[model samples]
Target chain A: MRARERILGRLRATALPHPPEPPEVASWYAGRQRNETRPQQIERLRSALEAARAEVHDARDAAWPAIVKGLAEAKGVRRLLAGSGSPDAARLAQALPAGIELVCFDRPIDDWRDELFDTIDAGLSRAKGAIAETGSLILWPDAHEPRTVSLVPPIHFVLVDVGTLHPDFHTAMQAGRWAENLPTNALLVSGPSKTADIQQTLAYGAHGPRELIVLLIDEEGAGK
Target chain B: MSQPINFHPVESFKERGRSVVNDPAQRKNFRSAMDFLQGKRRAQFPERQELEGLRDLASAIRRYSLAQLPTLLEQLERNLTANGIQVHWAENAEDANAIALDIARRVQARKIIKGKSMVSEEVDFNHRMQEAGIEALESDMGEYIVQLAGEAPSHIIMPAIHKTKQQIAQLFSEKVPGVPYSEDVDTLIQVGRQVLRRKFAEADIGLSGVNFAVAETGSLCLVENEGNGRMCTTVPKVHIAITGIEKVVAKLEHVPPLYSVLTRSATGQAVTTYFNIITRPRQPGEKDGPEEVHLILLDNGRTQAYADAQLRATLQCIRCGACMNHCPVYARIGGHAYGTTYPGPIGAIISPHLRGLDQTYPLAFASTLCGACTEVCPVRIPITELLVRLRNEAQARPDSEDATLRGSGAGRTKLATAVWRGWSLVYSRLGLYRMTSWSMSRGRALSPIDQGAWTRSRTPLVPAPKRLRDLLRKRRK
Candidate 1:
């Protein structure tokens, strides 16, 4: 304990510089001061949303069939739950084979209440964006974007727009404006949910999706 | 269901690797899994510029965070303690193991359900737990597979990267009798889930690894696709998190950048499925989570690495497993060949430092110095440079015969030293170099191979009739 204190003391002495807020922060505040002004953040968010939509459209056209076929192949996947925030989720639902239920939620519900809608074999949703460096899909849940669409299901399929893809973590945080108001829940999914707990055996779909498939839509390249 | 598979350390690693490499069926399964992942990652980024920019930003953040690690760690400890969580500092592997054991004893824990923690692997925590007569059950499915197989993780992110469905089926059949042997992936997963659910419910203590520790909020962040990490922290009566001291960041603001890098670089995902932030255990009136929360801050040679200006960058590693996937040597020989908890490029540099040059000398030479590992590193650590440093350190040991042989000039001490020094002097002066080259042309027919023992192992060089100096002389005339 004494040693821990000593180490802590040493650490405190070497704290990195935390410079004053940049001009952008002040500009953002100034914009907020003018009630009639168009908020730069909101505009950026809108543009990001538009870019995300375009990517999803392209992915739906190119990769929907294969994704549906893969999901259909899973043992228990009968229905897919998708979030309303994802522009592609609705389109993906329309593209699925007849009788395979794909439901989209615009808002959260009690776990028991949501469970009654359908037995979700898989979840299909659009990622807020994608990280290119690690192939991770990011999802932010809110009052409208329920967590169950990403969870609950045995297989989760995320549709990502290439325009929203960032190379590394730093860029992703910057673009997302993470420092301002972080979301309550954010998911960065690389692959299917997996666990290797019982004697070091690899098993997918332990507590979440057994399989995760992402459809990367090149909005500009595909001309969607 | 009975006893976990016994990993005999050295022999088992060779056996496991040989068997996995030989089995075509296993190879197909492993290849397909990796192929799917790589393909997804490739498809995720269409704009190369954007992806590159993100990588740069992520690398910068990690580097910056590690540079101020000591301060961040102290801040994190204070916040965690203020929130009623006990934080223990461990200087090395033994200290970490002892601390974990003491925690178990204090809680009177008979059974432990551990979430997948790489730090626990670094300290060999399960072995220590078993020695103390405590039953430690790995709750993550991938970890469970390696635990059952009695082996170590081949990949940092994917522990059972070397295992096949058939191998898993064989192990399952032996553990759970009367169960039909099936090579199907889903069947195996179902069996594992059913078995582990009971263990999660019954375990008295839960052990986990922290992804990020936020100093301002006193929160430990655990990012996972599976809810097992969540269950491990919440379901058990006591929750213990073991993590490296370098995992600390000064404020919550530092988390997003780190998260962005770790997730993207590890599996090429935008974000992990479940990013749970736990401040304390369950508060008053709370129904879930552990009653007591203990955070083990493991130094384990991290401070020593931090003290060295050249080595401090190694602490920036996020353990994303990108280096391993891209490393040609690691891809070919696999993880067990390295014989350390951490494997591949980062492991080659870190293991020798953590365990010492004597115990981990071979790891330094494990790499081909191909630079692929350095290229893919999320934090941009100069991995190849560090590996070279370790190699130099290994050669400098007091009892090193290899060093003596190289240092003694291979037999002809005086003549070799004088020749080497004279060559250096000649090279330093361009005019002298030209003069020597012109003189050498007079004896161009002499045996080049007979000049030194170093040339004895190679094909004899063709004697030059004229040097560049002689050509220059002819031009001048």
Candidate 2:
């Protein structure tokens, strides 16, 4: 506390005679040209996500469960983890093939830390929204949807509601009013975890999910 | 505990630079990596007009934030506390390390999984943790590789940029158990993933660096491509974030532009794989995320930089390492040659404030005053100008009334001062300048064959046979 006081006090003492006026950030930001229609936004999002090596599938809202089931079976995934209370998880459980099992994150991490880290082949979560310009998934992790669901597993399947997509980060934040109520952890995931650390050679799953598959819920069948 | 590569005399820094420059392999490695990074950055900013607009907006945001730094810091602390995240303050490196060590002791932590935090490097956090008998492991792939080799990061963004794949494979095979020699980057990364995963799950604490702390949202923003940052910050029971106080911005809206500029400048990505914005600890009924979140705002001579308006520009850096990538000096000597936590142009300007001018004055003079750094700076820091100011501060009169830097006038010498004064007199007077140039041209043959360090790589610096002014006069006639 004393350190804080001293540091702040010293800073105050050295304050400029007149604080500089804040820049017109909003006006400047508004001058940029980014007014794409919904389809164009989704197209931009798909291209950017695909460029980052993320698999983006265009699926109807009612058909995503079957798609997830097919993807899981194709990848030979046996154990899939999802949020216990998520309706999408329930739908996935009913749609999964008999050989695959759906596990819910109902227990505290302390109870299933080892299993989550070593046993789960894939994890599922729902992205709150996405940024089309960067193809980033905006994740607001909370009590119902834990943060690790998309991070710990080798494979992660995220459900993105196409209606929630925004043109860019600035638009997303302002439209979502993120500053009014930020969650404990808000994440923007663009692709599968990767690194160029070793001799500048890019490699995926350096510490996070090796694969990120985005299931776009195009209810209107707007995306081809 | 072992100290960081200590600040040595200017001669040793020069010697290290000389050795690295002479090593063709090392020079080639740096040259290729820099070229790759520069090309990627250029590709990202395809439109020069938009890039300039973004740069202007980014610079204004940083300047305004620094101007209102004190208020924003207080707001950040207040809001973070309200949000159940504890906040601690440190005035120097020792204070910062002690605060983190105290937390580790309180938690009875045996191991700490760390994301890349250059503040931790600045405060010598790992060595101090080692002294306290705790293993603060580096979880980032590049950091882990560098840590395994017991060396400092050569580049801010690419920690292991100095080593080749074959070299890394050899290091891993020798250091990591049950690992075979393989130069494949994928295999090496897989090996690292296996080792670090266990450490992340088992470690008692997670430590990270904050890229930007939003005062309005009470959030700590981290920018990274790897999932290790998320794993380290989320997996461990206790999460600790350390950042220089200058990282704070007033609102969340300022983040996107700066984030865009930062990623594009640092690694040529539109966005990293993960951008984590952590506001508080795990809320009620939350199944995961750290239960206890602590933020340490370390001053460590930042207040010194803030005292002066001109030097204050040094604090505007976002640690993108773009200047280093663009620096010809850094490309030749590499980051290790600077012998500071930060290297290149940014390091040269900021180190004087961090570790007094007496120790870092040499760094200020190491540059060629090329504006490449200033040209490429996303926030337009005017790095070359800062370097010149630092050089002046290092050589100012010790007892002068206006001396604002620690170790001011350390570079001053009776002979150098006298020579500079005489130089000013000769150059400022037209007649004296003409007379001196005329005599120097006539006496060119009498000049020394070996002109000290100048002749080390090239021929002697003998005066030209004729003065430039005389040649111009002849051409005019």
Candidate 3:
């Protein structure tokens, strides 16, 4: 018998009636702070991200680029990688300090594969939003700032507008209606890559970037 | 039925279990690790109401998905194919391994990299690949350690929980050269990182196990702390994901609650480092991900279990390993003792379905039916109830046509069956019950002290001094 036929037939033959739609999840676990102002949400997000081991820096829109440059200088990053022509990149390049080189991931990672993994000291991208509960940065990877920008390099830097911070993961997914028009790939990265595999001893940077630095752009009056 | 493979638990179940219990170091390793994991889980869900609510939602999602499993599987296959990902179905472990090997051959993959996939382990996958001259390297740190040691994973989530840091340090120094042996875990991790980084970049094919396969979007979701899972699915030219047919869910929103309960229950982490949801192979403009992605939907014997209404609850497992972590028997005996890919309470119920009663029925008896497993189960599988049901199955008639209960335990034979038959006959009838009680009370002195295995560690059970019926009458007077 065809494998698919057999497997599915068995399930079909014994299948029960479909139950009701999944109970409306009590996603309001984060609703306690629903009344909190946007600024409070940002603070909650920053604290959560910090706890997850991602360094968070508060900055204004114009100051965000300078903060990135400063982080580059601090990490001894020579060639700082950013998605070319991205909103975050345009601002960073305009404000980039002279000594540090700004390398645009202008083409596909395949075009500059060797440099991306080896030569690039760090990579940066703009996060779609931040989840305060788990302190995770959600990214919807596309052709422009592909997944690799946040993944391959030794160091990762993410930019998040303070207003984009959500109270929790479910609220973000629910509001976004992600199921309807989901991207080809979506990620929820909490911290720098870590592992406790070797006898439960925690270690960072097992494979992905060793460090995750979040540059929180605080737009004063910005609302969700 | 799952025959005893090179590393399968069937032939070596008792021996391996005995060794695991007798080895103080192994026992200590499991006890401490389980304690730490259980503690972490407890701390994460300090509020009972919140945990129970999430569990309810996750359980509903699992059950609802299973109710429409056939439709959902079809939808998943259709969506994946439309999105340019190939889907294959396997009725059993052998078929699954053969299909995976066929994919490897077509791709001419020499060195394959793998994330921690219990499904792959279920099929004795590494051994199969090696026989075909393919090297399957496990990239997950714990799995890599167990692979290097040439042993099966004792625990599902933490494959190398049986090894201590000192043991791992010793193994690394002995196997991977150029590094001086150090007991420091950070240093040991660095050594592993340096060695595995190259393989991740060079592997010809990447294989991973799916945590969830969404039917609505035709996507596979993976949760992991280390980035190896991402690298394997991304770097290789070809990626093959194998998962049980039971993993598919109805919608995307269902993932969050299930994902939340899973990590918190398994490792006591509020959230894992990464939740990667993949819908299609690298699209046309995409630069990094694999060019080809294939998913193997495996049935094994799950369909047989899924056929029964009550037994279907076993499919609700999310592979969180919480049951094992909180299992007292498992912590003491360790994972390798169960002799199945999955161990502890979940294994006991599920193994019988996949491997049949003859090979894995002993696992049903391995548990004390302690409710710790059932208590912490994310989807709240009635593990203890299932264990009791399986015990009855293990005693079913040997020639029974029931595939779900192939019945190969002590009661399957005629003598054992007759012993129960006569015993039941005496216990159920008033005249026989009175005669047996009177005879047993009068002949208490003649009872043998030794009763074989039962008397090995404890005294034989002795009859009561007086009959319960007579005592009740005296009380009435």
Task: Name the runs in model 3 displaced over 4 angstroms.
Answer: A18-21, A26-34, A94-99, A221-224, B1-12, B399-411, B469-477
Go through the candidates in order and give the clash count of each. Answer: 45, 0, 0
lDDT of 2: 0.92
lDDT of 3 by residue, B312-424 (tens): 99999999999999988899888877878898999999987887777787787778876989988999899999888888777865566543554445336677778899999
**Model 3 clash pairs?**
none
- 1 or 2, greater by lDDT: 2
Docking verdict class for candidate 1: incorrect
Candidate 3 per-residue lDDT, tens place, A1-224, comes to 49989887778787486466765665435533466677777777777777778898877887878888887898898888887667777788777778778887767655666667778789888888888778899988877777788888889999887777778777888788887777767899999999988777789988888899988887775433
Interface RMSD, one decimal, each candidate = 7.4, 0.9, 1.7
Query: Could you report the DockQ of all the candidates, in the order they appear?
Result: 0.16, 0.86, 0.68
**If you superpose only chain B onto the true chain B, what TM-score does each candidate give?**
0.81, 0.96, 0.95
| Candidate 1 lDDT tens digits, B169-241 | 8988987666789877768888877687667667889999998887767888888866778668766778899
Candidate 3's TM-score on the B chain: 0.95
List the lowest-lDDT window of 10 residues for candidate 2 chain B.
B1-10
Clashing pairs in 2: none
Deviation in Å, model 3, residue A197 alpha carbon: 1.4
